[model samples]
Target: MIELVLPARRKDLGGFEVGRVLPAVLKRAVGPFVFFDHMGPADLPAGIPRTVDVRPHPHIGLATVTYLLDGEIVHRDSVGSEQPIRPGEVNWMTAGRGITHSERFEKARAQGDHVDGLQAWVALPEADEEAEPGFVHVDAAQLPAFGEPGVHGRLIAGSALGLTTPVPVASPLFYLHLELADGARFALPAEHADRAVFVARGEVEVDGQRVAAGHMAVLATGRATDLVAHGAVTVMALGGEPLGPRFLEWNFVSSRRERIEQAKADWRAGRMKLPDLDHDEFIPLPGDPPPPPNPMS
Candidate 1:
């Protein structure tokens, strides 16, 4: 009975905003993806002060994958990687032990541009959780695309639909972006142990239940399901074998709370590293106590 649907909660981040659709009340993760954020569909008008200026921030024990549907964002990381990601391109940053980074809209596009995208945080496997911070940029043309005439799929990461993306990953998982014409149908792959669908725009029906835009349908395991588009729609499919339980605290995610604590101390003591370009503007930790107990625990 794959009927569980979790609605996204809107989050406002000043110049831009996003809808967080994952880690629902009963579910914390789908496969290795612990955090899923749907960014924008918002249009910043010209001549206004609307802008995006995310200051340098630190993260640990996970990889962040940013895929844009519209607009652009410039990514700068402690590893000295500076890349501007546009529509269909992907920015993958792994914060193993710890890393600092920032995201901001390009000056040219900040003046009246439509911004829309999805950002997913995939937790590293236990062995690779503390490896080394790294970054990779995969251009739009590099990803594989397939499916029927009206329905198209881009294998953004991992292997799916008889194709594998160039995006480097330390674990087995699938992150797919799908575009469906009216009445198009897509059958879910069954090789993965966990599966979920997030409808970004338009309407869709998965296994006979309507999934409106801004909602995520966490499918049941061990059975196949078909997704039919009620109209032109965009949806993201995610799944993989489950990693063990993981803990999350603000920007940090790890299997052990002690590791998160250590990361916090390192940031507070200025021991955490950041890129020289933006290091001077790193965000200071909030004065609140450590994050509350893990809701998924």
Candidate 2:
């Protein structure tokens, strides 16, 4: 049975500055499913400069998924892979034991561009945490798309509705991009009752509750939930078997405190390799003094 998990909004300051996070489930209970961040579907007037510079950071025991709705991002990692991720493509990177990587705006759009996308971190089971780092880039045409008229479903990862995304993953998870025309009603699969929906483009009605862009709707496990697009709506659905409890400090994610400490030491000692980028621009490391407290606090 599917159930709804109420979504919570969290704000964090990172190398890129302001980040708004809408977490559907608590990290402790959602095994393998750890960090999820919903980025902008922001409209940029022509010639407005946009940038996404997430500096070289270490990740362990997890895989990162980058999906873009519009615009493009250049991704570079320690493994020497570099690629520009655009709309309808998937950039899936697995940091088995540990890997460091960075994300920044593509050079062509660096001067004046726009972007719309999301980044999610999926925890790897203990068995694969230290395996080896690898990457997979799936073009937009490779993902499976289904659904009736007025509604279209794009499978970004995992299998759904007789379609599957080519991106290989370690867990039995599903990441879907769904678009619904105004007033269109769609039935979600009962198998995905535990999933969460993040509205990225327009308002949507799910289980009788209205969720607007920038907000998240968590559907608790039970019977399948129905959604109606209040307007032309775009949403992302992510779910899998829950992950075990883990610790996330700075950029390292581990199931044990000692492991995180070791990772920190390795990074500081230069034991870990930083991601390779064609350009010299790099993101600064974390641990700088916090900015002045918010006056509104």
Candidate 3:
């Protein structure tokens, strides 16, 4: 059964716009996913200034999952990792203690650069919150593929369709990307107690209600629920066991509020290192001494 539908809060970043769907006032998260951003399907003109690039930023107690559907991004991190992620590839960076990184678009198209993809932050388990930081890139070919020829999909993590993906995860969860032909109906995996589906580029029908693009439907798992595409659609199906209450502050997430305070102190005092390649600039912590972190549901 369907529970609630959340709309992405659109934010315009000069030539690009990001749609944020998670961590809203209504619901803090879906399973371990604490933050979710839908990056452009926007086109940037040739020779666009580099000022628009994401400056090096710091994160802790979570993993940044970057997947591109179009265009390219050069990822540089403080761990001496420099990787380029293209369409159908997954860039998973775990900032257990702390990590800094930046994403630059040097592969801008001649006429314009087409960027479209999703970035999600999964909060770490309490026991692994302070583990070592690391980064890994998984190719599209390595992800397990399933579904009929016309209705295809890929398992990005966990077990689904009797296949498990190679993407490393710290918890029990499943993430999937699906392409459904118009009028084709599909059942979501019921193994997880908490789950939701985000419509990235098309509308879908769930529980006799229509959910348009840039929106997500949180489902009450146990019984089966079928989603039918209104047209050709691509969606992300994700969720798993809950990670309990978490404290969120700026770019930091932790089970302990004092840990968040420590991260704030580290970034404010320049204790956190910036990305190796993009060390020339870094995003300053907003609000200087930010307000007390809050416990997220």
Clash count for each candidate, listed in order shown: 0, 21, 0
Q: Which window of ten consecutive residues has the lowest lDDT sum in model 2? A: 13-22
Order of models, best lDDT first: 1, 3, 2
lDDT of each: 0.87, 0.71, 0.86
Query: Whose TM-score is greatest here?
Result: 3
Q: How much is 80 displaced in model 2, in angstroms?
A: 0.8
Q: Show where candidate 3 strays beyond 4 Å.
A: 109-111, 289-297
Question: Which order, best to worst by TM-score?
Answer: 3, 1, 2
The TM-score, computed over Cα atoms with residue i paired to residue i, of candidate 1 is 0.93
Model 1 agreement with the true structure over 1-297: per-residue lDDT tens digits = 375788899988875778998777778999999999999898756553413567788999999999999887789999999998999998999999889998866643446667789999999999999989999999989999887877988989998777899888989999999999999998987878888999999999999999999999999888888999999999999989889899998899999999999988898888988777675566667784543333321
Q: Judge candidate 2 against the unseen true structure and give its global Cα lDDT, from 0 to 1.
A: 0.71
In terms of lDDT, the poorest run of 10 residues in model 1 is 288-297
As a whole number from 0 to 100, the lDDT of residue 139 in candidate 3 is 95
**Is candidate 2 or 3 superior in lDDT?**
3
